[model samples]
Target: MKNIFKFWKKYSFVLLIAFITLSLFDLRFALAAVICMAAPVFSAVFKGRFWCGNLCPRGNFYDNVVAKFSRKKKVPEFLKSYLFRVLVLVLMMTVFILGIKQNWGDLYGIGLVFYRMIVITTIIGIVMSFVYNHRTWCHFCPMGTISSLVSKSRKNKHVLNVSADCVSCKICERQCSLGIIPYEYKGELLNHADCIQCGKCAVVCPKNAIGYKST
Candidate 1:
């Protein structure tokens, strides 16, 4: 299981690129992007962002970018890491409410608003990933924000800390592109709204103290 997970994590970026290319060539293939939209739904039922951790192309790109740069910035610990979650909720509520009221059936809907929103949000997500921490966009990402919320509600949800095996080496925290303090989280496992489950923490962990499991 571990080997399979590692292999998927290593190659996820390549696969995501292929999916994007196929989506461009074939409209039907656009469903590939839905994987990002749908992955959290699956995680909600299963209790982990399995796709985000091991399959998301965007996640892979952001992780690499943050890992390459941003090592100098220090993240202050805070209890309300859900700031990202709040932004996502506001955006979604605005879009869905406004979109429904405006009624996309109007000719102006797709061109003026829908397409513009999509383009602007996409740019924001990509640019933020490069400029800020990895998966930083996930905090405000409508898709991820929704997923994180749903994934935490499952009856079987569990956070596997295994921190006893951890050595207080800040590697996991430092390498975490999402800015989560792996050592500071005292839960049995991480169920936070900000966790994109990119698995970089686990990868960087020297003692392999952090990992996830569903109850």
Candidate 2:
């Protein structure tokens, strides 16, 4: 099961392509967008931003496309601010709502909205890749924002922690795509709302100090 999960995480971009193709050619598959939209919420209840870390097609885009071609740059402090994230979320949701209302119960229209969303996100991901470090758009993704909120609400579940063996080396910080300073929070259960549970910190820790633990 774990290997299957890793495989899915590694190749999730294929699902994104498949989704786009289905949306363009078969209206019946339009409902997949709805399922994708709701998946973050459901997954967050159990594993906190697991969907973002392992199942998000957008994250796959960053990993496969953006990271391959872009220069690494530090994300701006302003862009990482919670207020900016909320504003971006509001704007995205407003656009999404307007698109839904414009489509109004038609499968083709719904599919078109999903299609446009994928295109727009892809473009944004490409643009952001050139301008910022890995997965910078994730900081402001509306679905990610919502998932973070849900994870925060259910703080006791699926928490990551650090052990006393931590050397205070900042490798985890460097490994973190979201800019979280894991060493600083060592020895404490991490429930940071923005934590995507990507496990890069845990994987890179030389002492294997960081890991998941139930609270």
Candidate 3:
């Protein structure tokens, strides 16, 4: 966990750079949202969320900015429920599509809708981090969820591997950024769909039992 945090911190400024284009630039900058979404989705097919852990600007923002002042409470169980995540995903995407349809002709109008979405969602993530754990919002983020699903689409996708020597210490579970219980899927791939390929579990395991494998 320490190593992973240190790694992301080293490049955390990327979030600020990306946010500047999204917020400080013209309406056209809102198109950045699509690129951001696509980056992770495309990577998930071959790498199982490598983009999320290594390159997601918002994830970096949470780790670097929000973690500083977060209250660090346990995430609400309701927020982690699959039903709730699906509902949030459906609702947000519905709103986005509707907004796009409403402004189908004018580029500025479409950009305005995207801009509003990025701003509102980011604020929600930041507020949730302060209210709960720094990564509370990550557990069910639409983009993360989508990346997980896309990764799962391929058989034998690379994921955190738990070897026979695992000490069952549960450190990996505790350190997982998305609250995934890695220990539960012992001697196999982690069963959870939110791994993010962060490798924090592998980094913190005292037994040196966790590693990545196609399984």
Best by TM-score: 2
Model 1 residue 198 lDDT score: 64
lDDT of 2 by residue, 1-215 (tens): 99987877777888878877776778657567777779988888888887787788768768876688776788888988879989988988888889889988887787777778767876787798788875888887778888888888887457678877789988899878788888877778766877888888999999989888633
Q: What is the lDDT of residue 42 in candidate 1?
A: 75
Compared with the true structure, model 2 gives a TM-score of: 0.92
Q: Any runs in candidate 3 off by more than 4 Å, and if so which? A: 1-9, 16-22, 153-156, 213-215
Model 1 poorest ten-residue lDDT run = 71-80
Model 2: lDDT of residue 114: 72
lDDT ranking, high to low: 2, 3, 1
Q: Runs in model 1 with CA error above 4 Å?
A: 1-4, 15-26, 64-84, 90-120, 155-159, 212-215
Error of 3 at 185 (Å): 2.4
Poorly placed runs, candidate 2 (over 4 Å): none
**lDDT tens per residue, model 1, 1-215:** 98976666665666656654554455345434545666666765675555555566666655554446533343333312567457666877687558647855654442344334444565565655455544555556666666666766653354445356767788887766566778776335666555666666877788878777432
Tens-place lDDT digits, model 3, residues 129-169: 88888788777788877877877676334667888888789
Selected candidate, larger TM-score, 1 vs 2: 2
Q: How well does candidate 2 score on lDDT at residue 18?
A: 84
Tell me model 3's lDDT, rounded to 2 decimals. Answer: 0.77
Which lDDT values do the candidates have, in the order given?
0.59, 0.80, 0.77
